[model samples]
Target: MNKLLFIALCAASGTTCAQTPATNPMPDGSRDMYVGLGVQSAPRWDGTGSRKVSALPVLQVQWSNGLFISGMSAGMHLSTDPVIEYGPLLAVQPGRDASGTGRSADGVGTYGPSLIGPVPEPLAKFDARPTRLDGMDKIGTRLTGGVFANYYVTPQWRLTSSLLYGAGNDHDGARLDLGVQRLAVDLGGQHHVSLSAGVAVANRNYNQTYFGVTAAEAARSRFTRYDAGGGLQDAHVGVRWNWAWSPSWMLTSNVQAKRLLGSADKSPLAERSTNLTVSTAIAYRF
Candidate 1:
C-alpha cells in the first residue's frame, strides 16, 4: 500500500511540472536599431496656392524587452503665389468715374454736365483709389520627436504611450497619446506581414504663434489669439506594411488620418487649415 501511494504522488508532481509556462523569446534575432530617410508632402488647401513638402529623417532604437524610442525631423515649406493677398485691405476704388462729363447750356441733359452757381456744391464724391492688402510669403520649419515604450502582456499584444512636440508655422503644439497595439495572426509563416491598430487623444495650443502673428503685432492689430483650451484632438488608426527585401533591410509604409474634432481657429484663413499626411520609408535594421 505504501508503494502505491508513492507512485500516485510521483504522477501528480510530473503533471504539475509539465504545466509550467514557457519563457517568451526576444524580438527578432539581433539588436534592433534602425535608421531611415524619406520625403512627405501634402496638398495645400489653406488658400496658400502652393503645395507643401517635408523632408524627413527618422531614427529608431528598440530593445529586446519591447521598449523603443523614435524621432523624426522635418523641414517644411509652403509655396508662394503672386496674386494671393494675406493681409488687411489698404485702399479701394469706386465702380464709376464721375469727372468725365462735359458742360452745356441746358441746366440738365443726358450724358451732359450742368452749369454750376458761384458757390457750387458737388453732386457726389468719387473715390478712384486702388486697394491693397498684406501677404504671407515667409518660409517655416517644423521639428518633432517622441519617445514611446511598449509592454507585452502577451506575445501578440502591447500597451504604448508617447509624447510629441511640433514647432513651426502654424503647428506649434504638444501631444500625448496612450493606446494599445496588437499583432494579428496570419496563416502564412513567421515572415508574414504584421498588422497593428490603436487610438489616441491629443491636446493643442492655438496661440498667435500658430497664426504667424507676433505678440506685439497681435496687440497692435487687436487680434485675439485662439486658445484651444486642451480640447479633445482626434482618434487615429493605422496599418504598417513591413517588407523584408533582404536580411538586414526592410521597407515600411504608414498612413494615418487625424481630423480636428474641436475648433482651431480665430481667423477666416485659419479656419480653413486642416492637415493630412502620408509617408513611406525604407530602413536598415542593425
Candidate 2:
C-alpha cells in the first residue's frame, strides 16, 4: 500500500516538475509539491505476466536545489543544461508479491497449478520456505542505486536512460532502461499530452532470480526446469493526457501496452506475451 505514494514518481519520464516558490517559509528555496488520487494498473510482479489495477495515491516533490523524490526513486540533479540533466539515484525495488500461487488474482498463474493439474508442491529446496500452490518465490522490496541521464532533443522531445544495480539480496542483479518521449505543455495553458516508448534489459541473475525454474522445482511443480538468461526483457509504449480542469486541479489518464521479450517470454510462468494497463488521476497542484 505504501507504494502508492511513489508510483508515478518512479514512472517519471523526466516529466516537468514545478519548482517550489522562493517565498516559502523554509530557508531553502521554494519546493514544489503535488498530491493526487489515482488508479495504477501494473504487473503483479516483475515476471508474472499478470496485471492489477487498483486505487492509489501519487506524490511529487522537487526541491529548489535540483533534488527530487518520486515514486521509487530519489536523486540529486547534477546538471540541468538546456539539453542534458544527469544525476545519481536511489530507489526501492517492488519485489514479488507475497501472494503466491492460486486461481485468484494473487496467483502466479491465473489458476495456479490447477490449470495444468501439475505436481504443484515443494517450491524450491534452497528457497527454505514452505511452498505455495503457485510455486512462486517471495522477493523482498530492495534498494537499487544508479545514475540517470535525460537528453532533450527539443523542448518537447527527450531521451532518457538509466542503469540500476541491486544493493542486496532483494535483487542481486542489475537492469537498464532507455526511453524516448514526446510531450507538449501549455496547450492554451490547459492541456498536456505525452507519449513514451521504452525497452528494458536485464542480466542473467536478474532474470533467473524471478523467471527461472530449478529441477527441484520442476519435479514438484510439474514445470520444466527453465534457465532464463536475460537480454531484452520487455518493450512498451504509452500515451497520456492531462487537462487543467481548474487553477487548483488537473485530470490525467494514460494507457500503456507492453510485450515480453527474449527468454522472459519463454518461461512457463508467462501465460501471455503482451499486456495492457490504464490509469487516471486528479491532483491538486500547489
Best by lDDT: 2
Backbone clashes counted, model 2: 7
Candidate models: Cα lDDT each:
0.30, 0.53
For residues 115-214, write the lDDT of model 2, one tens digit per residue: 1112123224324322232554555556677887777687566676777888224456777777766644445767766666777778888777667777
What is the Cα-based TM-score of model 1?
0.47
Top TM-score: which candidate number?
Answer: 2
Runs in model 1 deviating more than 4 A are: 1-30, 43-51, 63-68, 73-154, 163-174, 184-225, 265-275
The TM-scores, one per candidate, come to 0.47, 0.75
Candidate 1 C-alpha error for residue 61, in Å = 2.5
lDDT at 106 for candidate 1? 6
lDDT of each residue in 1-286, candidate 1, tens digit only: 1100000000000000000001123455433455776654432322111234555444544343333333321111111221111111110101111111011010000000001113222112211111110232232333344433334566554454444455334454554444444443333422323333333333444222233344444454333333434444433344434455666665654433333334332332232223333445666766
Candidate 2 Cα outliers beyond 4 Å, as residue runs? 1-28, 46-50, 98-133, 167-170, 185-188
Global CA lDDT computed for model 1: 0.30
